[model samples]
Target: MDDATARTQLESMLAELDRSITVLRGDPDAPGDRSLADAGADLTDADRARAMLDVAARQRTAVLDALKRLDSGDYGRCVDCGKPVPEGRLAARPEASRCVQCQSVRERRR
Candidate 1:
């Protein structure tokens, strides 16, 4: 995608994340309740919320990182290999800082 499209997507994702965080914060369910016999499902829900929050947090970080790159005039270069990240890859993952090969190698190491 183009920079405009990527920016739009990031904005939308950020707004969705904010809404999700608000919902999670307002949620009343808890993992522990002495009055309840089975808190398994509630705990699972809490876990799911936690996982979602983590994802949102990462997305936020990616947005910030992208913004920083934009400001630095280094938005499209691969961080790992100093290559220009292809438009197709950027379309797939606007937050990506590495080319596919570098990303694959990094993931393998991790």
Candidate 2:
């Protein structure tokens, strides 16, 4: 994908992630409005919200990094191998910083 297209995609992803994070955080203005009387149920909901927040935060960071890479002319290059990440892969995942091979290895390590 072209730089312009990639920038647009990254910006859009960032906006969506921001919105999701905001929703996951719930209303900051109302902190003591727990409807559930059961402490276990409240804890479960809080735990789920925390997990969603963590995922959204990670996604936001990736999108921001992708934007920085665009500024540095390295948006489509794999950080691990310095190879030009495939355009199709970039199209599918604008925040991807590794090519297929490097990503596979990284995932296997995990």
Candidate 3:
């Protein structure tokens, strides 16, 4: 995808992620505001929220990194192999930093 399109998508993703993270975190300044984890524990709701928050935070970081790459004119290029990541992959995950091959290899190592 072109940088403009990618930027728009990435920015939208960033905004949504930010909202998710904020809601999960809760408003600390409010009256006795507790986090999602603190608000509920029955049926492991707190644990579930914590897990979701962690994932959202990590995804947010990825989006930020992708934005940096876009600014640097390095977006859509695999970080490991410097190959152009497929358009399909970018469309699916705009924050992706590796081609499928490289990503597979890295996952195997992990």
Candidate 4:
């Protein structure tokens, strides 16, 4: 994807993430049904929300980092190995900071 497309996608994702945070903040205390099973379900919902929030946070960071790279004229290079990341991979994940090999190695380490 081109820089314009990447920026647009990142902005959209950021907005969605902000909306999600607003929803979560609006429900600071989760309401639960009377039954134990129902309460458990509420906890499950909270867990899912938390997980989504985490993902959003990471995505936001990734986008911001990508933006910085764009500004520096280093947008398409892998952060880990300083290699040019494939356009196909960038199309798949615009915020990727590592080439496939480097990313795989990083993931394996994690």
Candidate 5:
């Protein structure tokens, strides 16, 4: 996809994630502000919200990093091995910083 299209998609995602983060944080006047007194249920809900928040935050960071890479003319290149990342991969994950093989290696190490 073109940079403009990618930018639009990323911006949309960022907006949605920001909204979700806000809601997950629990508004004082909203239903989400209920006390965490139900030990079992509230704990589960809070845990899930925390997990989602962490994932969304990481995704937002990645998208922002991708935008920076675009400005630096380094968007579609693998940060690990300096190889050209495939357009298909970029289309699927515009924030990817590693090619398939390198990504696999990194995951295995983890």
Candidate 6:
């Protein structure tokens, strides 16, 4: 996708991830309540919320990183191999920093 289209999409994803992180972490704007300081440690099912919060935070970070890469003109390139990531993959996951082959290798190591 073009830079403008990619920026628009990435920005939209960033906004959604921000909202998800805020809600999952607990409303930071909530008055006299457990704000984002604890990262939703005070919520019911602390364990589950912790997992969800972690996922959301990771996603938010990925989206932010993608935006940064976009600014640097590296958004569509795989971080590991430095190859152009497939459009289909980017269409499905704009936050992806690695292409399928590199990503598979990393997952295997993990």
Residue pairs of candidate 6 with colliding backbone atoms? none
Cα error of candidate 6 at position 77, Å: 0.8
TM-score of each: 0.79, 0.90, 0.84, 0.81, 0.85, 0.81
1-110: candidate 2 lDDT, tens digit per residue? 99999999999999999989888898645656565475678788889999989989998999999999999998899999999999889989999999999999999999
Which of the two candidates, 1 or 4, achieves a greater lDDT against the reference?
A: 4
Least lDDT summed over 10 consecutive residues: which range in candidate 4? 24-33
List candidate 1 stretches off by more than 4 Å: 29-38
Per lDDT, the best of the predicted structures is 2
Per-residue lDDT for 52-100 in model 5, tens only? 9899899889988988888898888899899998889988987888999
- Candidate 6 lDDT, tens digit per residue, 21-93? 7777775466664568565565545678789988888888898999999999899999999999999999999
| Candidates 4 and 6 compared by TM-score, better number | 6
Please report, as a residue range, the 10-residue window in candidate 6 with the lowest summed lDDT: 37-46
What C-alpha lDDT, on a 0 to 100 scale, does residue 93 get in candidate 1?
Answer: 75
Say which prediction, candidate 3 or candidate 5, comes out ahead on lDDT.
3
Tell me the lDDT of model 1 at 107.
96
Instruction: Choose 1 or 3, whichever is better by lDDT.
Output: 3
Report the error of model 2 at residue 3, Å: 0.5
Which model, 3 or 6, shows the larger lDDT?
3
Cα lDDT tens digits, model 1, 49-102, are 888888878887887787677668788798878898888888777777888899
Winner on lDDT between 2 and 5 is 2
Tens-place lDDT per residue, model 4, 1-110, is 78888778767767876887777655656565469887788789889988877887788788888888877888889997899999999888888889999999999999
lDDT per residue as tens, model 3, 14-95: 9999899888876545676567776665337556778999999999999999999999999999999999999999999999
Candidate 5 — worst ten consecutive residues by lDDT sum?
A: 27-36
Ranking by TM-score: 2, 5, 3, 6, 4, 1
